[model samples]
Target chain A: MPSNIIGWARLIAGVLGLSAVAYIAVTGNYLLTALGFAAIYVVFVAALNLFMGHAGQVSFGQNAFAAIGGYGSAILTANHGWPPMLAMLASALLAALVALVVGQATLRLRGHYLAMGTLALGLISYEIAVQWEQVTGGYMGISGIPPLSIGGFAAETDRQVFLVLALAAVLACWSVWRLRRSRFGRAMGAVAGSEEAAAALGVDVARTKVITFVAAAVYASVAGSLMAHAVGYISPEVFGLHMVVVGFTMLYVGGIGTTLGPLVGAFVIGMLPEVIRGFRDVQDLVYGVVLILILIRAPGGLAGAWRR
Target chain B: MPEATLLLQFLVTGAGTGCVYGLVAIGFCVIYNASGIVNFAQGSFVMLGGVVTYSLWHALHLPLAVAALGAIIVSVALGVLTDLLVVRPLWHRRATMFVMILATLAVQIVVERLTLIVVGDAPMSLPPILSRGPIHLGPIVLDTQVAFIFAVSLLLVAGLRLFFTRTATGRAMRACSIDRDAAALLGIPVSRLVAVGFALSAAIGAIAGILVTPTQYTAYNLGVPFAISGFIAAILGGFGNPFGAFLGGLMLGITQSLATVAFGAGTRNVFSLAVLLIFLLLRPQGLLGTAKT
Candidate 1:
């Protein structure tokens, strides 16, 4: 339970992730391509942990923010020809603004009401992405999105994208670690544990909760932007209720409260198909059954076992 | 058809859809009342009813009533299974509400995937319990299925009201909902009541599924949307109020229908969810329930 162990675990995870990318890039394996894409989700699951694990709110609607971020960047860069950097920044801001509005509106609802409200909000965002074809390009999605680049070097290949995604994931994890140790992060923990007590302790409960919500939103938006550039195409289908569940699963399976939990959760969930490669026909079924067992027996996640 | 008749047709369809949602919402309210948990897997119960009934009536060639009865029994068993498998273990651990919600969501995934593996991915449907036709009354043309749905929903609401107000078991459940410890002290078997609440909720969801599947084909993934819309309806009518859930469902159904007419089908979900968000902000107590103190 020592803090140094978590720090070491995170450092090891980062090193292993980079090595995996290097291995995949050298061997040119087809299967490892998924790991590259999964790097973005590592960022997402970590972001989700900030809200659900650190801040203590259950939101089934984080997919809405991803859609906002994904579509916002895709439209600006793909359609308006904005620079990828500018579009990414602009989309993250846009998604944050939307999150602010949504969080302000529904954060007052206690418990499951907030969960349902967020779910509804996510579905609404998805509807907008799908139906507002003039902007989102409908189901066909926006394609030929420019890749992320700096100066002379463009991330034109999967290896470069993976490296970029890895940096972002590391950055996200570092920031969350910093946040967890900050005064604001402690307030989030207090608010999550007990809103009334936090308020009595003068923590500005609503404001702290909203801040965490916005932070998570920005993380998701940034991840979404990366996803847009990586795939060079974006669609509403990419962000839906299904992704929301997947993101939640990653956080839970990893362990909810810890900084290293989301990373571990995302890695395990992302690589689950490879782990269950023999159950090709019933992969989804087996995955689901394992997930249920985990939730029932080891609700704390893999990290939970370690903590115990 | 005249504009008035066109409007009436839309309203009629909306009412039918609302009835289905209300039925599901009532299920949500029942479970919510018994346990503070908002069962996200309520939708799977709906799917179970529709799919099981379809297989029984069509594949096994059972009588419609027999198939429907069998489907209801399956739903009740699944409801009990859910409590045993997911809710009880977590409740014992004293996990947070968020954990319970995640657990139910996991259940949703497990149930949907298992059902898909067994049933295949193709959508299935059943013939209407009665002969399929539209009933014309002046300017309004109503599908017989819609009329049946409305009738059944109303009957359910009334029956549930009587059950809660007149029956001893129902009274015990109400007591359990108000205070589990107090009810237990009063010699009411709180755990048994919770199981009954879930089973009853599941049975109601199944009935709604059976009623609707004749028209709208049943599929594995259909439950989440049903759960969402039904939850919205329950919230709209005020959680834990069965009659309120019914009314909320009807209102949502009508609004969705009208919204579809105005903004197109794609915006239907957006319109309903938007309305729910607005309502939650404005009147969190819902239309029928007293304000939470």
Candidate 2:
């Protein structure tokens, strides 16, 4: 098959799959929640792809930024009566600041050390979310969060909320696509290829990694805030290590380096539980098996396979 | 309790758990030395050790010692399987470090899920191998279980020392860790040694699980915490040093126990994680490890 034909096929299939979900959500109520969550994850996975796939760095703790963004948004809006948009922006800034400090500290380390450091960062954030009862409400979580709104227009209904989230997801993907074509993106590719070579070629390896890490954190933070507004509830469990696992699954299954990989991967993986809802007890087992098979068989991921 | 005595009690308890952490850290060292792969599934072996033993004893009515032995065998087999089925293929293909990490993580999740399916999610425990009561030593009180942990750990450490120093295979394994290409050129069965390393680590993790499960409960979800703590211990001991890992584990365990007393139970993980971050930044070479070239 010609390469363009394969690309077209993927495009059509993605559009159709997304349209089917959108139609179901618009027509009925059952799938709305799942669709909303999937949209949020789309943003999350795309941002993760920027750091992991493009930048060629490992971070087991992107969820830390997400948690920061989430708790920031939740607290600011729920307690301080701030508007949702302002709260979301504040949360994103906070996550970016955190990513800056943490990235500078950790990105210097090579390979496993970097991975371990990031993992620790994430677990520590989770511990705080659970332990800080006064702010986070502990396991009970903060509830009654206001719905996302802009300029006095609030997304109150499920359909409206899903639409807004879908728009954000699309914006996230589009930005990632644009960024991939930019000079900075190419620099990230260089860093991923070989840090020493990239450094020798004047790539400022450390700065590129830290910048990308911060960008990814901002993406995760925005997604976190979106999740808070969409669900109207915030809890530590929502942004735990499991989120990292899920993000990885989506990134790998969808095609990590590819532009549309996050969307395709997030949609497929996000709805997988619903697809296998009947096998409740075996969901995680099935996920693990599927992930392993994908790694072995389609190492480049579904998107990468499609391109080939 | 007097302040000093309470502190002493906490230290004793911490040391007991620290022994298990040391064992787990040693397992990490073995695999890392043989192959560059960091098996995130290491904790799953520990979980299996306790959970499998409980099932064999409680559900199948096996003798306690037999159950424990059976659990170790099963865990070792799984470890071998992990290497053969998961790590080996990825190793052969020269999968990126990220892929390898993700693959091991998947293995961990699969093992945890399988354990949950087989044993259910409720926590399980083994009856104490030794007598039930705490042994009072003047002002300090020590649980018999803690004593057993120390005894087992000391024996294992001594045995490992002898093996490394006195055995042909152990020396070859060490050679491979020092220089894999050189060892391979010299006709060491590097791949097989990697499998053996996995098996050794699995055995150590299982023993730790069995020893510690009597004092606390074991559940399918406990694997990640143990994995995190063990990884910290590994880093603290310097990446690939077995003895360093042991010492690191003891330090981590005691610090965590003290943190629990000083702050609260929930902050224990926070303290350890803080220690991990601080150590990673300031002392990446670890306590006993020389700077990497």
**Predicted structure with the largest DockQ when compared to the true one:** 2
- Residue B240's C-alpha lDDT in candidate 1? 81
TM-score of each: 0.91, 0.94
> Using alpha carbons, what is the TM-score of model 2?
0.94
Candidate 1 local lDDT, A1-308, one digit each (tens): 33787767856766886687678767767755567666788889888989988888878888888887788788888889888888889989998898898789888887888887887788778777877888888888999889998766888876677778878878888899899889999999999888999999999988998889999999999888888988889888789766776787777788888888877777778777776675433555555566667777888888886665
* Sliding window of 10 residues with minimal summed lDDT for model 1 chain B: B112-121
Interface DockQ per candidate: 0.60, 0.64
The residue-level lDDT of candidate 2 at B228 comes to 86
Model 1: lDDT of residue A96: 89
- Model 2 lDDT per residue over A1-308, tens place: 33587778877887798689868777967777778788899999999999988888898898999998888999999999999999999999999999998888888888887877787788778888988899899988898899998887999988888889889989999998889789998899999999989999999988999999999999999999998888889898889877887888888899989988998888888888887885544867877888887887788888898777
Q: Per-residue lDDT for B38-98 in model 2, tens only?
A: 8888999899999999999999999999999999999999999999999999899999887
